[model samples]
Target chain A: MFKLIKQLTSLVAVIAVLFAFTTESMAAKKSKTLKNTQKKGFVRCGVSQGLPGFSNADAAGNWTGVDVDVCRAVAAAVLGDANKVKFTPLSAKERFTALTSGEIDILSRNTTWTLSRDADIGLTFVGVNFYDGQGFMVRKSSGITSTSQFKDGTSACTNIGTTTELNMRDFFNSKGISYEPVAFEKADEVVAAYDAGRCDTYTTDKSGLAAQRTKLSNPDDHIVLPETISKEPLGPVVRQGDSVWEDIVRWSLNVMIEAEEYGVNSANADAMKTSENPAIKRLVGAEGELGAAFGLDNEWSLRIIKQVGNYGESYKRNIADTGILPDRGPNELWTKGGILYVPPAR
Target chain B: MNFKLNKIIPQLVTLLVVVLIFGFFAFNAQINMDNRGIEFGFGFLTQESSFDVQFSLIDYDGSHSYARAYLVGLLNTLLVAFIGIIISTILGVIVGIARLSPNYLIERTAAVYVEFFRNVPLLLQIFFWYFAALRALPLPQDSEPILGFSYLTIKGLYTPSFVWENLNIFFYSIIAAIISIVVIKNYAKKLQENQGKQLPVFSISIGLLIILPLLTFLTGGVSLDFEIPVLKQLSTTGFIYEGGLSIPPELIALTLALSLYTATFIAECVRAGIQGISKGQKEAAASIGLTPNQILKLVIMPQALRIIIPPTTNQYLNLTKNSSLAAAIAYPDLVLVFAGTALMQTGRAIEIVSITMLTYLSISLSISLLMNWYNKKIAIKEK
Candidate 1:
């Protein structure tokens, strides 16, 4: 009788546990992250540790840059205030894990969108904000202008757990030049190692090279080679299984780009709400129900534009005026003979 | 019978509850992963890694599989641990003995070293060694070779590579010499026990070891040559030593920091072990007219080892685990390559992290088992 009692209780416990899990697994209709962010009254954003023109924080801990503008745009659209954002600075290795593990609602770091990261790693890349390419930086004293002067046994310094490692290998192998890769976990460490003359060249994204070059002891000593090794379309990322939150972030960035195309600055965003053109009016929340699809108010896009400004304004404030990259180059809009294009906000 | 049933029933209930909780969590993870469209599998191990490592012991390239990359990382980790344990043991024994020396300066220095290195965090020390100390080394262009054949620069220590001819024959000769020395030592031990004779076995073993390996070079088809490193210029100012064994500064810094930090604790363990022995035991050995060296070797050391082995084994294990800090300095150890880079690339966080944890557990257990065996061997025999 005692043995039978034990057996019966164990069987009952197992079935009850199964029921609990099965009930919880019936895929959520609404985004848990969105609900959590709303309850907390802030959007949890993950950005880079410190990239100058991407998502760098000032001495007062106020984050600014194009990537920061993405999360700020989201905060304006969702939370109704641009400053209602908590930024979690992440390393290259910890960025995706931070997003997928629910540590952050939106990872607006300058993370490259690759197939494996999007399709395999439980992450969804909404859209590209920065189109970058891997490039090499050599010391000006090395007297090497192009990558063709790179010889066998040349050591290269780069950050670990980044697409730069893979691209570096591809570049060196294609050129049949045997090279050494000294990969560190932090960007600052790579710069320090390269500045210490431990490596013959430093390799990362072209923009990164341009930004980090200023940090060297003598900024005039290094020169970036004229070689773009791989295509790196860096963008914001969100966790999988939350399409609604992903669409909200996606449209937030798209609205910024579209606003830039429509010549709507933050100063004129309110005036543009009464513009003559329908497309311009829709961007400022005057002509359409575009906000309804995202479960937001009609003023969401307008708030983003008026508070966070358009993409061009963000680029000028953070990247160009800061002297990281003076030219607009490929980051300029499609109508201005650049590749920054987005689907029209209809 | 009733009492046994009463005890067993509660224990069984507790065990069942624990098992059910564990099962629920495992099931929850599976379901959550399923909903997120993240596949859980180790099939990526066989896929092409498509990544390169800076310093590897084995022949590895980006063309190799991820498993091969994993092996390279494991080997580098083991290499650091092996070198650290050996160096820390030697340093610890000397410093332990020095701390008790009659010389005031030597004892004070030893005391200061143990307190300073042990109290500072190992990570800070690692950073100091790599970022501060190693960075101060000269660049390859301006480097001066220390031994006319080896260059120690910011990049690494490039030494002359050994080019051996018929290495197998040379190894066989050395093996033959070791076998004979062991056989002779056994005979000498029995002769001492049965016939009260003491042969000079140590001298004989040394003679055989030298003659056998030397004889291999004379006639057994063994020849050795050194491939000296030559400075090669990448650009006008960039230079590197090629055609030799280049040990990266990462390995040197990590090994130096691990051994130095771990040696301090090991030195304390040794000091405690030596001091724990009673003074009467040494006085009694002196009364028996035994020499001081014999008293130390045959009497004091045997007892002190029983105290030292266990704690020293702990320090060894700590050194092995702490070698994972090589990730910070980019030594490509098991953590940096397998957990840091591989996990980031594959995004199989659960699988990769679990495998890494299990690997560290296995390495630790194996070290523990080996130490336990040695402890048992040197333990005081009881009737």
Candidate 2:
């Protein structure tokens, strides 16, 4: 009996010791995601499962979109290699949880920077990359030119748990027009339902409309209405309480925008390093100790521009040139009548 | 004494280990949540949901609380389960009996049905119904009226609903009729047992049920008006039905898949129960010179039902739990509305998941308890 008791006590002690060691190590690892990411030699980026011109994969499994560019830019800035990124495709419903649970280091999934998501979900939105607004798409044969022409009992299909649903309700109620919202969890379902005539209209971001329109059987049959209902400043996101990691992601995006503002394209980025412009010198790490502030190398911005190009190049190549959404209404640099402005790198 | 000590000590140590592991998990979760600065509470249940459900049984809007949204989801789930249970039972009994038929075609047909539906995954079946089959339906403007009153469109099935007047008085009449019938049935049963006298209790009960409700319509000012659906054009091409009850295609697809899938299992259970009965029992009934109907009602069925019911009740419970698959096709059941959308909106993973789990657990427990009571009532007594 004494032997059994001693053995049991020793087993319990051994397990307790192991548990304590694991918990202690986990606590130590939790505080330094940047270091862990560096050690892993890749940044795990959470992206949308498939949204063309935003974050979509091709037949060859190569991910390329505006959101995908943000991930590559971050990888270029942090690891000095644009290919040092692993994209984990996530649905809108699981995006925040995945980031908060440390399943992914950054969520560049074209997620909206909503107040509740920022304040309540333990996530921090870096900055807006795509300034979009919710719009409606209807068949051209419907003869509904504007949103005002939508009468009572019009049914609209949209994705559930998105700002689109709330915007649809608010738009109809504010206009005194009663409409039914047929919501689905997945984006593909919404498109399928709309195509099947299960709904009279479809509601989503204007960019989403353009991207998803390509999937429709007759893309030319649909028209996006002119009225923009809600502002969706889609941006990258990071877990809260890690100011260092948050700054790394935020500045990586800002570098791209600033690169465009400084007239720095991928073609001229290497030659522009020797230019006499103070802001250009600071951006390319030819002057100043700005990179030390975010614990990155001095040539972080230069690597980003060289690997992923400026914001204008990414937007044009992935969005405009692809004919998914050719309009760059408000995404151009602030100097050229748009809102793509960022703080100076100093 | 040593043997007893050994057993008790090991059990106590195992209990301590389980408790310690649970405590360790709770402690880690708390620390992790604290580190992330996420507050844990159920206070958000009373907050405005600010999210609209496409199809809800109750009067719900975005202004309602999350608690109310939960109720709407719970009610929708219960509705699917209730409808699925009724349809599956009827189909199951028919197919089960058909499988035992002497006719070759009927037996093969029953076998084919069981083999087909039972092998396919429920989620895929739901997808096939919601996406492929229902999508083939016509638009509202192009839809042909069924029986000149209802319309079936890709949007939904619009059926004529009754606008009832004096509904409470009609309900009271029904209750009164049921009570009187029950009293009469007890007296008749006593008369037969004590004096060998019988009464037409079944016919009398049916007569009361119909007459009581009919009398309310005539004398109590109870009226019902049918409102048929009418197509209204919003634009050149947009059309929708007005003034009727619209059953969304999600509900139809969900219930159809659930019932068809569950009926296969129930049919197998019924087949097993019937086959378990001995041929001697049938011959023994014939020897007593009883009629075919009497032998079936008093001998075979009563015994077969004793075996059939327990497994059938298990299938009913399975059907209820499987209704969670409604989330896949966006039917807005408890799992979709409360767990999927609400959890995403609130970002309270622990609270929302636990509540959803507990709700399903309670539903399953209550149903099993009811089935146990029914099984006890139908169980044979040995004297």
Candidate 3:
């Protein structure tokens, strides 16, 4: 019997070793995402399954949104065509693994850049595209206009693994009010639960709240509370140990912002190339070695602007145009009374 | 000698190949982790989880360790499985017997039930219960109390919980009762075997179970108090039940879906077991002047159980595994709390997922081991 037990233990050890091997083999080879993506002629970008104005699809299966446009801009910069990108819709639970495991070259989901996620998760946050904060949405009929009115024992629903859950706890704990959280794995589940009145309030990023409110049966019945609890710098992410790939994704996002800062959008990008303003000239890639530094052509920023438009244009087209939330608020350019400031292309 | 040598050579080659494959994988994983600069360790288990579970059977909060969070998830999973198993077993037995009923309506009803629940996917059923049916229930302020103590509302089902004093003594009394009953049962069996005189063991055991537990409340310094749920208003419109046990709607939906789906398969197992009993055994017991009840109790049930147990145990294990689908509806089961939330929080995917899988594997193996032992114990001894 002891001998049989010993053999059984060895068998289990063998099986564990086999599983470890299989999973490792399943992972895409390390640090070759950039080369592989270029060779494949399309960028595999991960986005949320469906969060309107962030990363969502229409009935015809055409993907469009802010996150989708980021991927498009990256594709245009790297491959010279915005359409040379494939969007893999990922849930919050699988987004990081999907990126680290090489299933997707870039994760453009509306993911927050937390310190632990940056340092510990074998991933790097490229840059923030949308400056957001956690907030709450409650029913208008509840007679509660502000978050302070959410007395002790208030129930709120939010996604489980996002910063929203932790922020909710922090907001309530600091206020010394006890609350119950009805968390779900999916964003849609949280929304559905809140719509069904399982929770008195729905909490997520304010942008997420705006996008999700449009899905509710009676959108007008809900009101977003006027308190932003935690700062959420939502942005694109890439795997760690791949500085080349990280720089490409980061600069792709920055170039769009810099173009917007210089008032050089897609419609006027070619026209702006003639301007002698050195900043505009450099941003349009008319006279600078900025593109070569990132291993792209001199006209990389021009391709990004020409194909996917500037950051503001992408926001206005996908987000503001959709009327999910017309006011860009903090997502606007720095000179235009918002905090969107990108460093010089030089 | 030649045959044995040939066999040993092939076996040795296979073992070498397996070892080589494992070594290759371990080396690759090491290189992969090194490349990513991600440390591989189980040290995270002792760190503060800093994540709250929506529903847990134990006292848990954000301050507890991840190990504690895992325990909460495991306990919640076991709680759901335990309740599901008991309810499904009872329902399955009734439905199984009803399917064999002489009444056409009864048998048809049972058949329809089995077909309906068995055909629908469990995930969809959970969604239907949680998202649609439970959502349609009245809000807390509008809901009428059930039995003047509990409220079933869209938020959750609020019921009274008992506050017990000296609960350990009560538990000890119950254990004592069970021990004494076992002793008496053995003594009665010995008497029956020796003198052919039967004792009323069933009644005596039931009496001991009830009386001893009651005796704890009377003289063992045990007291119990009921804390009923009370409605409290948060805002003008929002009302909630306070000061009692609140069973979250997620658990209700998960348990309901799991049992309803599994009971169909269990019902089929039971039906097949009973039908496998031949008519000869029944007729023989009846010809020996035994009543119908006696024939069923003495001859058919024992035979039927031997056929019923193994497969039914498999169904129970499947139900436990299917409880992992609780992640879909956010029931905070082992999968949702540990594998889903904790893995997302820590990003230690390999370690967390391996732990979760091993936990389930151990559960399955232990249950199967117990069932095997029981099967062996009840196997008929050959002459």
Candidate 4:
């Protein structure tokens, strides 16, 4: 009986080990299939929660944003359904790992593409979604105007797992200044610290600075610095190995820029299906198999436009209409003296 | 032959099954890590960390290697554990004695303390102290000095950082006092055994301990000084304290929770140790012409320690392990600095996580080994 019992226990252990291995293998296989299906060819997009003017869910929980349009336009060119894409809202720390792990097809979470993150972490940055910089917000009574004027030994409030933290340290260090840092893991904590007078200044992205300022008890009392110390080129990121997935993500962003340039929006998209221009005709898939190379049909771009709208349409509704408008700045298209340029659809 | 075969075959089969299971996991882990391009290695320990820790017991910067960072984290963890153990021991003994007190109010008050702190989770207690409790403090500039030496501010508790001069001479004096105590204890034991004479060994040991350290200060050039924090303003509004050591609120909260939580268990152990001895033993000692103090010193303590040491050691071990929760409050403990941040940067999840888990396991195992030896030494000698 003892012998039989020992045999049974060992058998259970072996079965448990086999179960774990098979489950892991099955999970890997499923992910591979998901990747192939996305590339053959649908837009696998990731987005954020209601961060008004950047990315947010509507009353129905449908994502709309300057960042979201980048994904939708790619879907239009690839899958023929801009609504065919999947959006996943990610926390600050989860964003990078999600992209690297292939858990999300693409990350467009206002994530800054840094040199070390790009080169060392093995991720590909297709294009910039927003060009921002780090700034500090302080109470008006603090009498701190420029970041340079802020002396050493002041406790500055900041968030963890963001380039804004590194920028704050490097900027202060370069100026031969030393400050006691008070870091928190969330935006709410940083806001609370600043509001409670626990910190001399709260530093983050310029857009984040604006958002956090609104949450303060006296929004008018806080002033953000104008000297943008670091270049935070926020954009979408993808895994390193898959070229097919990378191309799909890159073109999705380009399609949005191209649509904005061509004046093709959700309202005019159906009319564009009968346009005279060969470029528009081909893009609308009224003519050729340009998308089939991406493992998608020719009507893919049209569907994307119909579902999510053009870049200009998305930007205006998501960011500009609310309060922050792209004033012919870096976000404007190349035709209007901006840097947003797209590769021609051959 | 058949009976022997039954035993041999089953043992062989069990061994084969255990080996097979291990082999399967080893095989899959190899393949899975290879497919993901993650190589398992401890080489990251020597690589530049490029991360800054907020609180450290030792000097550290991003320029330091990951190994140094681990040391910083390990040392900080030990520091908190040591402080928590000392505080809990004192609090636990007092509360445990009070719980058995004749006075109704004192007993009730001790019971209330034990019940209130014991029920709450250590993490919540830490958060309450750090976020809600510490946040209510005055700013550095407005902070009133405590005892004219320390400043209690929202940033942290800034106390006078000690500057020791000729510390080695002072340490030698402590060692000398300890050696004399051992000699005196042995002499007293011999006097009690061979002759019917008794010596005041405890008082002599106490006098030696104080007098030796004092002698070093007077003649051996041993000195100590306090670096008090002074408030300084850089700008019109911004102010900070400098020159003194600042203990971050995270450490304060973590230690506070660990001590208060562990004290309840330690109190139970203390009460059990005291209550364990029958009333008959006290009466018997009195009948044998022993004084009350002598009965406590020679009989009760030796007996109570036998009961107390085991549970108290367990509490110390629990406190050490629970210190890992310091990660939640960003206390730069072993879990936060080494496991969380270092693993993210290096992408060496398997290696780093295993090392950290093994470190904690070894600490626990070694303590258990010492406990076993101590238990064996104190066991009753009987035929």
Candidate 5:
């Protein structure tokens, strides 16, 4: 009996070692989501259903926007082509689940970075691409020029599953106002209801209000009230647990901002590889091995810059050119009296 | 022993495989969730929801917990289902009976309604009613009162809210009337069976039902009043009716679409049930000196109900499940408020989804149980 017990113990030890070896090899093959993306040859990206100047698709099925450019930058870095991205249009309620469930590799849908979302959910916000604030839009005929003019029994329309709902309550509760919240699951329905006079005002991120304002029957008739209710830092997000993939997305966005700061546009990116500034050379993949960390060629950042352009170019082409919040507001560089700043990529 | 082993071993192996498959899936999900740092638990239900809803049956606000918000959504869903069931059952019976009518126009019309409504998808019907039909209603300021003080407008149907004094006394009076009517009905049945006597039970029951509730106003200390809606303007073009029980246009559209859609199926069930009753049963009842009404009520209806209850129960379950589409039109039903909004807020996908599935399963099961019990009560006894 003792001899049999000893043999069984030996067998258990051998099995444990075999299991350890299997996991160790498997971990290398499946270190994260990067291997899957590389094998698939396209970056799976999640975007909003349709928010013009952000992630809306054109009549020809081409998607272009600052938010779309983020995923394009990632695609260029990892897959060596900016256009190698398949966009999945998601609702406000579905974006996070789509990302965390491996349905999409990157979620660049103008999602706000909130404490609960960043820390609690299985998601990581890469960085902010747009700085927004919640505001109310009322018809010009109402003569309600400001949020202070909103009266009791006023009905507000908004999308559900957004921070806008919570902020609207805060704005009302703080001001001691009793308002009706007509929350819809989709942005289009909210706009429709608000347009039909079912709601006294519409509320969302100010940028969203502007983009959606263009869809109204008479765009000039509705006016967004000048009151910033809540700070909304919108950005791209990725699934947690894949630090390599997370860093690749984070630095891809960072590289775009850094290029813009150094006055490097897509037209001048390839030529600037032989620049005097070490920072510029490093950005254009002329000086350092920055791409080694993400298991890619040294030209990853350069490809991102050459294909998707810099932060300023993305903003100008997608947002300013489209006539949606053309000013850029606080999204400009820190040197230009704005808050757009990122760490140096050494 | 060998025969038993042949059967039991295979069964055991099949059960083992099923359990192993389920266990593997659960284990894989747990590992993935753990790796991603997503804690799986129901602790979030007790946290503050901090979001406002458009309409609620009970008191609710941002200050309430997540559990309360779930309750609000559940109540709204139940409310729609309850109202839809009642309206559909009434319309279904009429259409079912009309289909059997000798007049070609009546039968054709019923058939057309059933075919058109049942064939067209329910989601599109809901969207049409909410976005197009209700969208055509006038704004509050432009609304003209329909049926006296009630106003039908884009906002909602603004009807006078009933305010009762000593409402409990009124309910107690109603209970007393119902109990006495049941007693009288049983006694009258016994009298007819034994002595060939008859009583005007229908008239007596109706009189008792009306007079008891009415008597509460004079002697039982029950009084009632109506608070009529008044139109008020919020802005130059924004207006709403105040001081009444306002039925939201969302609820109106959802109820209208659900009843119209489900009534088609229920109508088919009813028609099938009535047709299942044999002509011999009707002839036998007529030969026994029974009137047409008596033949239908005593012979045809009792037999027909056995078939009707089971299928009608399925329709009820379908209607309840279909009501989840209320999320599309902003009706604040279970899917919208709890599964949609609450799931987004908490990010508890696994937990919230499971709870929602269980809730729906329980509702369907309860309906099935009630119908099955009733079916058994009316089933033919083998003895």
Candidate 6:
């Protein structure tokens, strides 16, 4: 009886081990099955929740921002209507999980594309939409002039799934300063900590610091440091191994940048359809197979540029020239000496 | 034989059904994983993790393997769990005694505390502490020095870092005290049993504990020092404190919420424990000429602990498991560091998540196992 019971227990343990091994294989398999099911209709796009310039929903629940425009451009290319895309709002912690879990088709959130993220984390960054860098925001009364003056001290903030925390450490360490990081889980908490004098300085992507500074009680009392400490090439990311879907996302961004370079706004895109310029002609679907390469319609690029406007238009309307009025410094087209460049369509 | 067969046949059928279904799943999974480019193995655990953690109880970096990251996360989780359990136990006992106090105000105050914290969701409470309450703290530079050397800022509480020399000798001294206490307890018990005379075992134990540890400092060359935090300026007005060890805000919020929330349940267990002893037992002890302290130590506590321990152990287990909610606050606990960031990095979601769940399960199981053994040892014997 003792030997039988021992055998039974070992068998049960083996079964449990097998059960666990199967579950993971099941998750990977299920993801592939989902790819087939998600071939048509509206593509689900994961976006940021209420970041003013990048991705924010309106009072009417309409999504609008530079990131939002990227998703809509993809939707226009794939499903014909720019509005067909579903915008699933995600927090910084939830964004990557939602994408990898196949809860969303495209993640157009203002995510930074880093080496670890691109190579180590199993996600492919399509392209850069916003070039950002880490900066510090401090109250004017603090008399802090630059990041170098901060020294080894306290910082009030939270960061996404990357080396922002490690970067902060390195930045201070390089200067031989030791700091106590008062990191929180959300942007709102970071702001509150700063406002309530919990920490003397708030650090984040320069764009986020700018957006947060505007919400301060005395906005003028704060200064964004002139020093841009870290390179933050913010862009959209997708799950790796899906090249077909990757091309659609990649080209959707490319069309926007190309549109901006060709001066093709939503209003002028329709009239410029018959233009003699080869690049504009190709973009408007009058001269090239750019749309066909992505399994999209010939007028896919046209509809995107016409419906959502160009990259420059999207930026100005949402973040820059609009109420936020974020300065378009390096975000200008490559032809205009800025780094917002796209590869040639041909 | 026929009657036994009727019972045995159904059990056999049910077992067969379970096995078959499990087999089918296993077979299908083997095929599916093979179809994809993904390979199933634990080899990835030893490969370089190439990811950094913010707060770790153990040394770790990107250069470490996934196994090392797991260790870092596990240690942090255990550290938080141990700290929370200790704090909650002390608070619980006090509140539990206060509830039964003759003073109406103290009784009502303890009751109010129990109701306020126990009724709220743990996650929301963690958020409120981390997001709203802790956020109101002063910046490191602007922070007022606490006890002359420590700084409590919005970033986290900073205390003077303890630099200990010859720590092993100090530790050995404490171990020696513990061994002496056990030996004293046994001798006292034997003396009571054989001669019907009891030694003041508690006082003797306390004396040994203090003297042995003091001897370590005097003769063992054990020494300690503190590194205090100082304020420094960065960029125009940015002020920060440097030098001292900083406890990140997440750890603070987690401990505060976990302890406060679990204390209520523990208090209830304590109250139930003391209330379980019959009034007749207490009266009989007093009639027998036993003092109040003697009655408690000899009669009341023995019975009360029988009722208290099982439930208290369950609460401890619950607290350990719930510490996984550290993921929500980015505390880099086991689930957050391993199942979260590492899973994203390796794309081995299956392995990472299972390891996380199993880690929590084992902790819960081990505590339960210990509790079961204690319960068995203390169970009432019947003739």
User: Highest DockQ among the candidates is held by which one?
Assistant: 5
Deviation in Å, model 2, residue A342 alpha carbon: 0.8
Clashing pairs in 4: A74-A252, A76-A300, A76-A301, A76-A304, A77-A301, A80-A300
Per-residue lDDT of candidate 1, residues A1-346 (tens digit) = 9999999999999999998765542222266777677779999999999999999989999999899999999999988999999999999888877887789988988889998899998999999989899999999998999989899999999988899999999999999999998988889988988998889999999999999998899999899999898999999999998888999999999999999999998999999978999999999999998887776789999999999999999999999999988888898999999999999999
RMSD of each: 7.4, 7.1, 10.5, 9.2, 5.7, 11.0
- Tell me how far the alpha carbon of residue B133 in candidate 3 is from the true structure, in angstroms, after superposition: 1.7
Off by over 4 Å in 2: A1-31, B1-8, B191-201
TM-scores for all candidates: the values are 0.95, 0.93, 0.93, 0.85, 0.95, 0.84
- Per-residue lDDT, model 3, residue A311, is 87
Q: Comparing candidate 5 with candidate 6, which one achieves the higher lDDT?
A: 5
- Estimate, for each residue in B104-160, the C-alpha lDDT of model 2 and write its tens digit: 999999999999999999989999999999878998999988997999899899999
DockQ of every model listed?
0.60, 0.52, 0.51, 0.22, 0.63, 0.20
Candidate that beats the other on TM-score, 1 or 4, i.e. the better one: 1
> Residue A2 of model 2: what lDDT?
100
lDDT string for model 6 (B1-383, tens) is: 99999999999999999999999987775664454335567888998876567688888776789999899989999999999999999999889879988899999999999999999999999888876777677766677888898887766778888899999999999999999899889999999999999899889988999999899888889988888877666645555566768787789999999999999999999999988889999999999999999998889888888899899998999899889888766688887778766665566766777788888889889888988899888877768
Q: Report how closely model 4 matches the true complex, as a DockQ value.
A: 0.22
**Predicted candidate 5 versus true structure: per-residue lDDT over B1-383, tens digit per residue:** 99999989999999999999999989998998998899989999999999999899999999999999999999999999999999999999899989988999999999999999999999999999998987799989999999899999888889999999999999999999999999999999999999989999999999999999999899988999999998887777778889979998999999999999999999999899999998899999999999999998999998898888889999999999999999888999989999989999999998998999999999889888988998999987889
* Candidate 2, position B269, lDDT: 83
Rank all candidate structures by their lDDT, best first, as comma-separated numbers: 5, 1, 2, 3, 6, 4
lDDT computed for candidate 2 = 0.90
Q: Between 5 and 6, whose TM-score is larger? A: 5
Tens digits of per-residue lDDT for model 1 on B125-177? 99899989877899887888888889999999999999999999999999999
**Second chain alone, TM-score for each candidate:** 0.96, 0.95, 0.94, 0.92, 0.98, 0.92
Model 6 Cα lDDT, one tens digit per residue, A299-338: 9899998888899889988898655646787888888988
Q: Report the interface RMSD that candidate 2 achieves against the true structure, in angstroms.
A: 1.3
| Recovered fraction of real interface contacts per model | 0.72, 0.60, 0.67, 0.17, 0.75, 0.30
